[model samples]
Target: MSKIKIMKKFNFIIQSKGGAGKSFFTYLLGIKHEQNKETLFIDVDGSTSTSTNQLKFLEDQKRIGVIDLLDSQDRIARDRLFGSIEEIAELSYSNYILDFGAPESEQLPALFSRDVNQQELKGFAEFLNSEFIFHVIIAGGTAYGACMQYLTDIVRVVGEEFKIVVWMNENTLLNYPKQVEQILEAANALGLDVERFGDVLSGSVFDTKLSTIIQQGLGKAGIMKSGYMIQTQMKKLTAEIII
Candidate 1:
């Protein structure tokens, strides 16, 4: 741990609907990064349950993996949640990527609830502010436009400082113009800090044998060519961050 560098902790402010590759992205993170026991994934998204099941089912056997960290909505009440998030920053780890619940995901409840008052929002914001890594990821589809607007509004009340990252998730398909535009429009409406917004790590990052499993699950085959494909824009962005 003494040999590792301590940088600001970051949370991936992630948003999306089911089947938009959130878990797939996390699986890739698992594939490439070193796993430290000190690290913790604060899964506000219940996707962890199903995603973990998928991972296990793929092996056709029992599996002991971090994917099981996903908690139910009822478990969100734990005080240790914030402590775990803080530890992710303080402990030795290269990065902490949090995959938040999708707007339509029923398992993970809403954050900006009418039932939950401002006091709760402030507490949540304070916890996130204290986190060494704080970030956000926006879903790219035009369908998710309203949801993005909702997140911007939520972050505004919570505080606009979360490290927001927009994932364009570009592929050959679609009547899509630009995913970035959707992200910008929503952020602009809520007056978020977007001067230096992060780049979309194109879907190509999911290139591995595990990715093949994902494609097969989706009833597709060999979606992305084999090889390492880095998101150049994000690589440069991260390099700027490193120095």
Candidate 2:
């Protein structure tokens, strides 16, 4: 008999520059995962409250775990926030979709900073890798140029151990495919081997029935028309995502 693959998937949806659809994409991925796999969501963007609200539907379903890192500028708050991540990473066997928000957005990069203990962070990465196929998925909005900068910064800090996935989130006036081309050109200019990077997964959730409903903070209709739209887009996006 053939053995089954049981690799846990940990997707940290990130972008230092805000309004890049981090929360939106996180919710989509979480909903998709809940169809089968055990999933957990950590909303670190307490300021925006977008993902926190959009995810309420799932929370009510009692199908997944959700944590909100409190919004604060205090150093202690940052510590507790980072501590929660470590705590969940240690205890959970389910797949994780961590939606990072403001302030503490720098925590992941700080772990690999020269000022911190790189050795310890590296060991933690190893532990996570042992249990999960850890990947960092970045969502870039219409400001494609700024998104490229964030990508490079993360690539520099995290090193090459983790797979980096680029998501072209269409929110601006710029063309989606063009932005993707520019991102690749930028990555090549930075000496990153494009082959190792996961394929660019692009989509837009704006003006959709689901988005409109969520924006209005209305009650769930149960089996919504917009849900089908989201699932269709997510199916394509997830298919492109190399696990």
The candidate that achieves the highest lDDT relative to the unseen native structure? 2
- My TM-score estimates for the predictions, one after another, are 0.52, 0.69
Supply the TM-score for candidate 1.
0.52
Model 1, stretches more than 4 Å misplaced? 1-8, 31-47, 50-75, 78-80, 86-90, 103-134, 140-142, 172-174, 178-180, 188-210, 213-243
lDDT of 1 by residue, 55-170 (tens): 33323222212322234544444344445555554545434555555642322234334334446644564654444222333445644554455455556544443344434333
Q: Give the Å error, residue 120, model 1.
A: 8.7
Task: Single out the weakest 10-residue window by summed lDDT for candidate 2.
Answer: 193-202
Give each prediction's root-mean-square deviation over alpha carbons.
7.6, 5.5
Q: What's model 2's overall lDDT?
A: 0.54
